[model samples]
Target: MAQSTEAIFIPHHVDEAFEVSYAEAAPDFGPLARDRIPVRSMAAGDLVALVEIDSRITGRKRVKYFERKLQDALSESDVRVSLVAELDGVAVGFIMARVDLGEFGRVDTTAVLDTIGVHPDYQHRGVGQALISQLLMNLGTLRVENLRTEVDWNDRVLLGYLDRCGFRPSQQLCFDRSLG
Candidate 1:
């Protein structure tokens, strides 16, 4: 597929600017499951459902966080990627990421996964995997080279899931200092 060289503005709080283009859907990877779960690009109306899914998974409401993240992603459609998995037209899982080019002086284009959540009822039902698989397909359409995310070191469940998804320790180390 031919690529376009349009500039994208990722928010300064996360990273700098980059050239981006809307991705076209890649070839289907066969049916993702016996029970078909539809995953698609997030629409603005998905906000409430997304927040509800996350809240159910975490056992707490985080309306503002999701609101801001969704707004940012929708505002910068060329660079940010947001996807939701639905069963019978109800959202059960979601993943949000933004494409970064040369972030921190690196040249390769990377997708920084900001957040992903699967409702507890939907866990182990391939919803999360389906969401990820579709995200990867979409990223390939945009020519993104890698997918990066941060997870708490002690969160073994998430780590195992990522491992199964083919994630390994990245060459770049993350540093942090507590502000007291």
Candidate 2:
């Protein structure tokens, strides 16, 4: 018997937005079992799982921060995109980002990757990559031309991951100052 699958493509209303959902047969990832991994659009109820994942990775709780970000992302779907990866029905990874129609007067759309986290136990098992891949796919459907992320210079692991995911240094520089 053949297996059944479904794909959904959701359309965004913003300018140049593309459809971002489709159904497909189950993917065979060679030795990497694909059936156990699932990525989907993030919902408001996923906040608790996101917070737990971030807490496990950072060794501290920042519930308020995630609450605000999640609320913003959920409330603004046209400009924001967020995804979650699940393993056996439990969220193991997530990526959050938003689309900027123009920055610094440039007319091209750009995606800003705000936060990504993977539970430590799932770090090297393709959870993070799965989350990012879904994000990129969604952004592509939205006709976003570029993706940007900022990382502390000391974060070698994240930098390496971003590099492996095809992110390169941009010509523009990022400047920041503490209000305090």
Candidate 3:
């Protein structure tokens, strides 16, 4: 793992059939399923299925809005969103991320994992892990300085996963509310 003098190992994850050349990243990766689930970086064709899954799971489905947003994000160079884990070629899980090569405050540049979600029925399986790993791989390919995610303080499962994936507590938090 000898990197150049300025080369830094940015924390990232992968979500699909990661090439074995990056076996070391395997620790942060997981199988989508044992021959049952097929992991993939989603494409435009999956719009319908993803919408259906959302409606069935959360009862709050907005297909066209999301489709437009996805299309816009992909059209942008600074944002790199990778959709993951489609069982039977149907969209079941996804990871959305952004890769920015601009400094936040003092640091140079970074990639941030914005959102990741799997259908509730598909929970407990490794779909989420696979999605995460895949996103990290994408970030690595871009030479991102680091990968970051904003987590709800109460999401213990997510917190544990991020810890296992080698993220540290880089900042603290404060909450605010506005009332009329």
lDDT against the true structure, per candidate, is 0.79, 0.78, 0.65
Best by TM-score: 1
Q: Output the number of the lDDT-best candidate.
A: 1
The global Cα lDDT (0 to 1) of model 1 is 0.79
After the best TM-score superposition of candidate 2, give how far the Cα of residue 26 lies from its true spot, in angstroms: 19
**Model 2 CA deviation exceeding 4 Å by range:** 1-36, 178-180
Predicted candidate 2 versus true structure: per-residue lDDT over 15-122, tens digit per residue: 565544322443222213222468888898998999999999898899999999999788965765888889878989998998888868899988889999999999
Candidate 2 vs 3: which has more TM-score: 2
In order, what is each prediction's RMSD in angstroms? Answer: 13.7, 11.8, 8.6
Q: Is candidate 1 or candidate 2 better by lDDT?
A: 1
Query: Model 1 Cα displacement at 112 (Å)?
Result: 1.0
lDDT of 1 by residue, 42-74 (tens): 888988998898888788889899889899889
Better of 2 and 3 by lDDT: 2
For model 1, the superposed segments whose C-alpha errors exceed 4 Å read 1-35
Count backbone clashes in candidate 3.
Answer: 7
RMSD in Å for model 1: 13.7
Which pairs of residues collide in model 2? Answer: 6-23, 7-22, 7-23, 8-21, 8-22, 9-21
